[model samples]
Target: MDDGSAPAAGGYVLGSTDREMARLAALSEVYGPVTAAWLDSAGLRPGATVVDVGCGPGDVSLAAAERVGPTGTVLGLDAAPRPLELARARAAAAGLRNVSFEQADVTRWRPPAPVDAVVGRLILVHLPDPVAQVARLAGTVRPGGVVAFADVALSTRAAQPELPLLTAFNAWLLGTFTRSGRPVDMALRLTGVFRAAGLPDPVLTAAAPLERGGDAVGWSVVAGDVAGLLPVMERTGVATREEIGPETFEQRLRAQAAEHDAVLVNPLVVGAVARTPDGGG
Candidate 1:
């Protein structure tokens, strides 16, 4: 919203914090633990200063601090303050003082100093111009510092005979993105975005949905994702917001999860890790 320009003025994030975070949590599925592994695999060493763009609720930021250890610093940037506030609480609860959260629309803001790594998870999709955002991120990290992100891949094809509804949901989600001006193709463009910003070509990898426990342990979070995506689908007239009632949606998704004898997870999300050149990009 707000035209993706300068800082939004104390604006609310389109939905209640509880619901919004829950929505983000669902579509993101395994982002937290997966991010920890992604950073480790990238060789982000101890004491590495990290910036987590779109650090909603701050799980990735705290994880980065844990991986980097006490010597490192983590700064999380986000557009909305409610999520940042929650992130701060999460950091405190996790006893991770090395990480802090800031409220700034990163599209118009840049980190003041080079960081050891720049990361975002499920974040770039909200940007109106992700290419420009990646270019700006390239400027914030030191030469050879790692920069990486992961998001849903639209080009993926699902062969989930067992979960056609879930598969259909994925298609509708991408359509919603297209209608909202935040096309899903950006998910496939991370590597190109890195290269275009003059950074090293990114090493790409992807994840397939695996079976989850029937309880999901994070079902409430799934409700949040339904909330987040509902707007997109509604805007595109793909689904009426009423049809996507969070409770009913989660109930159905959980039912689908039960049918999970093993169906493909629709989001063939891609993750990329790249080194910033020895010289500024």
Candidate 2:
């Protein structure tokens, strides 16, 4: 992987759009608590500096700031400008002076000084070489500092009273990532990546969201995620406009869920935390 500086011209595979921003915001609401727990387990604490890589919309960064408090500092980094702008706005609105967002490519970014921890969520799967990327992240922190990440293993998704449309859309999304040279289940390989990066064996944990019928928030979260990808899925021919049109696809999913009393189980999110050695990289 590159050194975290050379950003892709178009940035993230899921292009930044209004729908994508909404999706990210919903995801933060849904997953933020668990992610905060994971980061805390990874050794983030009051007055400790941290960096949130691929910090889209700054949810994790905001959480980190809350954890680290006023004395501590958190920097949010992403290649996309739109999300960074939103992140900045949210931070300002939230009155979080300890956190800041910057537009930077994780693959080529290098922190000015070593920090206490480096963290990212849902970003490793989009990289070509997650192991190398992890290594680079490890290098950004001080010795004995932590490197933590969370990502989805897309292949592990399942639903009860299965919604065919939802399932097929997920499959198509995974295929789109694969065709674009990204790993769809990088979380499953995170331990190996940490080891290959020369970090000690990482502590790993996983969770999945199980949303039952009539949960609008849950369904909206799912819909936002799927809708954000519809354009790319159609453009790549992984799906067709008629098959996965943004307007009706989510409605169909909701109808299916309501009709079947369905239980929607999204992909397992695997989190890994490793400590850099006493001798820095």
Give all candidates' CA lDDT scores: 0.68, 0.79
Model 1: lowest-lDDT 10 consecutive positions: 2-11
Candidate 1 lDDT over 1-281, as tens digits, reads 32233222222223535667665555455444565566666776888899998887887788788888899999998877778888898889889988988888777777667788989887777676667778788778888788898776654634345554555566676566555566556568887877787777787766645434345534444345456556545655878866666557767766776666434444566778888778543
Each prediction's RMSD over C-alphas, in Å, is: 4.2, 3.9
For model 2 the local lDDT of residue 40 reads: 72
After superposition, the stretches of candidate 2 with alpha carbons farther than 4 Å from their true spots are 1-11
Candidate 1 TM-score versus the reference: 0.82
Pairs clashing in candidate 2? Answer: 3-107, 3-108, 4-106, 4-107, 4-108, 4-109, 5-107, 5-108, 5-109
lDDT of 2 by residue, 123-159 (tens): 8877767888889889989988989999888776666
- Model 1 clash count equals 4
Task: Give the CA lDDT, 0 to 100, for residue 153 in model 2.
Answer: 80
